[model samples]
Target: MAQAKGNALGALGKLTELRQRIFFVIGALVVFRLGSFIPVPGVNPEAMTRLIQGGGGLLNMFNMFSGGSLQRFSVFALGVVPYISASIVVQMMGSVVPSLQALRKEGEAGRRTMTMYTRFGTVGLSAFQAFGIAAALQSQTAAGGAPVVYTPGFGFILASVVGLTAGSMFLMWLGEQITERGIGNGISLLIFAGIVAGLPGAVSNTLGMASNGELSVLRLIMVVGLVLAVTAFVVFMERAQRRITVNYARRSGGQRAYMNQTSHLPLKINMSGVIPPIFASSLLMFPATAVSWFGAGHQSRWLQGLTQAIAPGQPLYEIVYAVLVIVFAFFYTAIVFNSQETADNLKRSGALIPGIRPGRATGEYIDGVMTRLTGVGAIYLVLVCLVPTFMQNYWHVPFYFGGTSLLIIVVVVMDFTAQVQAHLVSHQYESLLKKANLRRN
Candidate 1:
């Protein structure tokens, strides 16, 4: 660990570009955190916080994703949720819509077109959700009977729609900039930042509980140990891959003499990464938020029941959440890592898996392996995401300790470190090349 730290520092010192990228990511995230305090135009931040503090529900999860922005009634309360939701819709459509599927296959042009569609969808979804939230706040009250919206009217709604929509759009742009200019994936890093921001507070609260005798010292120790163990497990699983050895065809007496060569096709155990949990949570949050908003205005038996049912930690909520996570794990894995395409590329490169035949047979074999791997991955996701909720219920573990939040934090950190390593390696290669050229000269 000490050597690893030294290597990172050494690399950052030598690799100016990597250091700049890391700095850019840090600066961008700090800006994001600051923006979380810029409140929405007409909403009462105190009242909103009171409403959240009153109980646990969808608000907790939303606040977690927004880095407490929802509780503050900030313009960024929506965060990148709209963007993510739009991505899900666009990707799903790309599968079914013939035109979209063709466009998706069109390479860079297709990507740009699909991205444009997703942006449009984000604006539309942002406006829609913004409207719902504004309208809902009109009827919502704090524990002290204060209205969440100070002046509920068309004016408030309009201002909110504009402010919130722009905030989401700005975040979308910010994330893109980070991806192009910084380290790791911009969107994932954004969500990771949000989740990480709340971690310290969660730790403090958990300790506070122990101090207050609400949680026994022994239980606290156990929770801490369990959390560490689970984190190690997550790291292990994320790094695990199924390696398929591909042997290249031997060539003799050609322009370039190519002897038999071997390389491994590395397929990650969780090829979908943290997308499944995040997407699953976003989907569930939407319907629950809608029901909560609508129920606030016109209270009824079913609506009240629904408000209770879909809240995180509820039986109905957990069951549905688990199912959605599993579904997305498989769906996204299929989309992102197509076994057929991988096999085709390998075949085109004159490589073959030792036991499997080339072409169609290879595709089938890889697909079969992927299917089994995805099943295991999906189960792992479900366990990681839901077990925290279970612990929160039974063990009273802090909110940040498990579930989607932990998964995202772990995965994003891994991705960022991997990118940094790659950059460092590239820098080393450039230095070697320069040295070789100098020697040759």
Candidate 2:
């Protein structure tokens, strides 16, 4: 009873210390939401909605991912997607470009340089995307023949492009700030917040549909049950890992005795994490969203046909999306874990798998393990993301509450919670050490 009480007290104390960190994260999120409401100058925010809805299909998904910011033509309309996409591009380039590859191997300095390149790339990409968006806005007209943009000219284009690009940069800075000074990954947490911001609207829409007899109560209940079940399953799979036993030899100095230590290398079931879904969703958006700008004449006959066929919820779209998700799962897994590097490091450290010899054998063994694990991980990712995706397509359900968004939300939240707990544990350890010193005194 006393031990339990002590533990509870310790937890409470740790929580108290974490209150400041929690507040900082909350403050940043609040700022983000506020930015999402601040429309860019010279745009009719209401008309922007009409334009987006008029475009249809994939733009809606893009708007949803941006947390309704895109639809509003808000300051944060661009979100952090440009940065994320640029980062992905830069990473892919680093693998193929000799200079970038060499820079990548240079440790902290290399990483800092690469991060700078990513930021530069983000600006370039954001500017290009913003220009495209500005051009699209100029061509859009309301039902009443009102212009979506207050004025259509180079001035408006320049201003909107600068505003959106700057907005993206600001968002990137905010995310970095959160990561450095607050709890959780700033960029991912931002996306999570955006997705979650749509929840109230989604729920209200569902209720409205149910009231109008568009969706039966039984169907709604079934959907909610399915979402809950999927959420639970994702949580379980996210935590699941394959543990490999590791043995470290003892090395003693002059008079000190050190014991050999043993630990388990935890290989997570979903090693590629939330990256695959993000890649798949972003890649799927490029063509579909780009076509919306073209008002019939802008698109070639074949391109228009392609747009209709490949838009979200289409059979062809789902198949391509599923394949991309699987491909990225393996690709990203390989990038994150290099078997040769791991084996070499293990060999240098005098560690070997139970039966496998060090060096080439260990590399092959690790490669084999990664291949098998990645296959499972890829299939798991495809099922979790696609099943609910297809449900949305077949049943006319909202994809917001479906598996892809839910997977990202759950995984990001889990990681955030783990980070918070780690900080709390460290704080408790410091307190214990301080008390020990006091007792010694």
Candidate 3:
């Protein structure tokens, strides 16, 4: 840890580009937070907060991911949710749609085309969600009977829809900018920032509960320790990999025949990264949020039952959430690393797995290995996701200290630090090459 800190410090002091990227990320996050505080037209932030808190369950989760923007009824209340939902839709389509699937092989042009599709989808989803939210807020009343939306009319709905959609679109663009000009995965970092933004209040709330005997000190300590332990375990698992040995065919040089070389392809234990949790959280939050709107005014029995059934601590919610995380884990891993494609590339490069044949057999062998790895990965995701539900239900831990938030925070931090170190290493290598060339000259 000390060595890592020292290296980070050295990089910051010596690497201009790394320093700039770090500063850029910090600045972008500041902008995100500032936007979170800016309320949309004709909506009462305090009233919205009261209504949201009363709704509880999924709304809290949504607010947490949005950095409290939802409770504030801010322009960014939607956050990058629409964008994430769009990504989920697009990725699922890419798996099924021949044209979208074909784009994956087109390289940079393919990526650009897919990104355009995602952005277009983001706009559409954002507008739909914003319109629903506007209509819902118009009907909502706080505990004291204050309207969440002060002016409930067509004008207000139009304004809210436009404001929220524009905010979502802006955030999508900002995230892309950060990804290009800054550090880390921009969308992941934005989510990380949202989670971290709520930490101070969560800590204070926990302390207040402890002081009031609402939470036992012993239990509080256990929660803290469990969180720390989970974080450490996640770090270990993220770095863990399965290495498969591959042998390269012998090559003929000018006057020498080089022997075959051996290498190992490292497959990450969690190839899906934080994506599965994020995807699951976003998907699960939607139904609850939608059900909530109907329950607010109508009080229908089925709607109420659904609201409770899918509540955060409920058995149904927990089961579905775990299943989604597990499914997305395997699904996303398959999307990210295609075994047949990898095998084909390897074959073209004259490499073969120890006992597997060069083409279809190699692909099958790799797919088998990946299937096992993904199973383990999916189980890990389920545990990490569900443990917090158990803790929040039984142990009374704050939802802010929940599993999804922690996984995202840990994974994003790991990825960001890894990128920073990689940048420093690249810079050093370039410096070394320059020095060697100068010496030769």
**Alpha carbon lDDT of residue 436, candidate 1?**
74
* Candidate number with the higher lDDT (2 or 3): 3
**Candidate 1, residues 1-441: lDDT per residue as tens digits?**
764575566556777777789999999999999999999788788888988766444677778888989899788999999999899889888877899989988999999999999999999999998998788788888778788888899999999999999999999999999999998999989988888888888888888988999989898888778788888989999999999899998777768787889889888888887788877776777655555555545456666666677866678888898899889889998877778888999988999999899999999999999988899999888888887778888666665655777888898888899999998888788666755775699
Tell me the lDDT of model 3 at 173: 86
- Evaluated against the true structure, the overall lDDT of model 2 is 0.83
In model 2, pairs of residues that clash are: none
Model 3 alpha-carbon miss at residue 33, Å: 1.0
Clashing pairs in 3: none
lDDT of 3 by residue, 53-132 (tens): 87765688778889999999888898888999898789878877999999977999998999999999999999998998
TM-score of each: 0.89, 0.91, 0.91
Among these predicted structures, which one has the highest lDDT?
Answer: 3
Model 2 residue 275 lDDT score = 83
Q: What shift in Å separates residue 215 of candidate 3 from its native position after superposition?
A: 3.1
* TM-score ranking from best candidate downward: 3, 2, 1
List RMSD in Å for every model shown: 4.4, 3.4, 4.3
Expressed as tens digits, the lDDT of each residue in 1-441 for candidate 2 is 765576678778778768978899999999999999988888887788887877765567667777899989987888998898888889888877899989989999999999999999999999998998898888787667778998889999999899999999999999999998889999999999988999998789989999999988888898888888878888999998887776666777667665567776677878888788777876777665666666556446676778788777788888998899889889888877778888898778867677778889878887887788888888888888877877688888764665567887998999899998799779779768766875699
